[model samples]
Target: MIDNPKIKTIENLLLNKRVRLVQPKNGYRVAIDSVLLAAAVPARTGDKVVDLGCGACAVCACIAKRVNGVELIGVERDPIMADMARQNMSANGFTGRIETNDLTNLPCTWETGQIDHVVANPPYMPANRAYLSPNTKRLTSCVEICASLADWIIVAQRCLRNRGTITLINRADRLNEILSTLNRGFGSIVVFPLFPKAGRDASRVLVQAVRSSRAPMRITSGLLLHEANGHYTSKAEAILRGAPINL
Candidate 1:
């Protein structure tokens, strides 16, 4: 249990109980998108991977479980979430550091071009366009406040090494915006959509790009998350159970 008097938290299982996650009880609980985002990252052993806006380190913990010996770092803007992320990493027997910093103003100590891969599940809604939540934490988690989607891409580009990969999961409607922002700095782009069910529209998309590469973009036959009866598809189940998926 979290010892903080201000924040009420609960322990939950992720990755078929392979990862134990501690998160706030009311605000922005860890979701399946976090697991899918973690699965999309193609990090290998010895790769230095950084997660931007890592609320409670869910992605970091999942990645740690999936890939052993990789260096993990997380940057979270909220202090409470950052503390929980550190605790979660420790509880999972993972070694990593959480930096409480705004994505727009990352610490100068983080050298440019040092990270092998950068992954982000950034806020899906634009601050001006979406309905704002009354709960501060939830609002920040769901809607962009201090940074825009472009800012996240810029930070990813800044941190990633040449030819390194950047992976992101966001609203499917934002594919155009995502691609436009990544156009000059990244290439070899892959857009993978996540359909809620067979013949249904995709609610989310996973986009991966390599910095400074010129390969053309490709869109895969996307994965369906559920059957018509609402059960998870076998492929989706395998991914949620800690299987690594190449984007």
Candidate 2:
């Protein structure tokens, strides 16, 4: 049994309260990025989806609530966070799996080219570019300590079946680098930008691709998350409230 009573944790609701997750109170809480990452994935019933660097498993639990019949697995490097992930999954009644292993060295049970869909909200900053958080969990979650962007993409490429979908949300400034890494094996790529407001440049982007598809890359008209008045756009609210988005 997890000794969460001794851990600094908080309960947060997502998907309009359809799901609840326990996250570290101060270190690396669930944010809009994880929620948007879960929303960007287009998974159907019976699909097998794996979340890389799953943290407290918020993305997987959110996806499980939204997509019925889909199988979910969360891979997290930190054992404490992984244990918390398991607790959150059970608290939310999610039957999906959680693996406390580094994404670069996933267990053999996750066979190559078997996953139907893969989603990740990888560390947005390069390890050398920013000040590392003193909190270990936050540090690993925000920087490429355990895995690089290329490493995450490589693992996704190896795990996805032919034509399987892989989706990611990352810093918008790194779109070029993210695309270059995805080019190794992913195609039919689509980039969806997330603007902070109606006319602002995107702060984040959601990128989706097929494992072995040959379709041309495209950038869609992106999502404006907020209005000039500081309220969430209706569309953004719908998605945050668990409305399915077709990516």
Candidate 3:
């Protein structure tokens, strides 16, 4: 892994944490949704956790701090991000629990039911609608390039064990697509809508589904992220800050 490239960008962790990511200004950068997904991941001691599309390995870093006893593996399609993820894993002294691997066709090395939990913050936009980056490597992994949502979900299904949980964050308008895909494979689902503030419609949603469960879905109350004055609510602050969010 090449050394962590010098960068000037800053990333805010929702709360205090050991792993602080120094985002490279030029490459693929992670966003608040990634932080939310990482914090919301249901992890248990010794759980085998895998992150799909781990840009710069940031989610794994946050997971290292928030979740205990999870042996983390980050799967990236881009070699640059994959290498950067390796370096990031090493830099944060998480080499032992975290590792990076690139499989152009995701779920390449994983066997059925091997993973306990899988988390993905997929490209929000569709391929044709997104603008390609000038950088080819960065282009390949982002939705702005053309990684299909179906491809990502199929890979997630292959890697997760029966009854394993799959968590995802996606654009609010795409909830129907995400739910349809999950229902065909896994049954039990919990969807939480995320709103920018009270009285505003949610623009994003977090989905949690278990493989092969036939239970009814439980939709949680909307998670209001901010108030009218741009202040975080108590519940929103808890999840954003990496505190346990029990819903």
Tally clashes: model 3.
2
Q: How many residue pairs clash in each candidate?
A: 0, 0, 2
Report the C-alpha displacement of residue 126, candidate 1, in angstroms.
0.5
lDDT for each residue of candidate 1 in 107-129, tens digit (9 for 90 to 100)? 65565999999999999999878
Mark the regions of model 2 whose C-alpha exceeds 4 Å error after superposition.
Answer: 1-6, 107-109
- Candidate 2 to truth, TM: 0.96
Model 3 TM-score, 2 decimals: 0.87
lDDT of 3 at 176: 89
Cα lDDT tens digits, model 3, 1-247, are 2344443344433345566565555656776777788877888778888888787787788777777667888877655556667777776777533334443444466656798888988878776776877866456655535456766677788888999988899999889888888878887799988999888888999898889889999989968898889988887777666775443
RMSD to the true structure for each prediction, in A, is 1.0, 1.7, 2.9
Output the better candidate (1/3) by TM-score: 1
- How many Å off is the CA of 222 in candidate 2? 0.9
Off by over 4 Å in 1: 107-109
lDDT of 3 at 1: 22
Clashing pairs in 3: 14-241, 113-161
Instruction: In model 2, state the lDDT of residue 21.
Output: 83
* Model 3 spans with C-alpha error above 4 angstroms: 1-14, 96-104, 107-109, 132-146
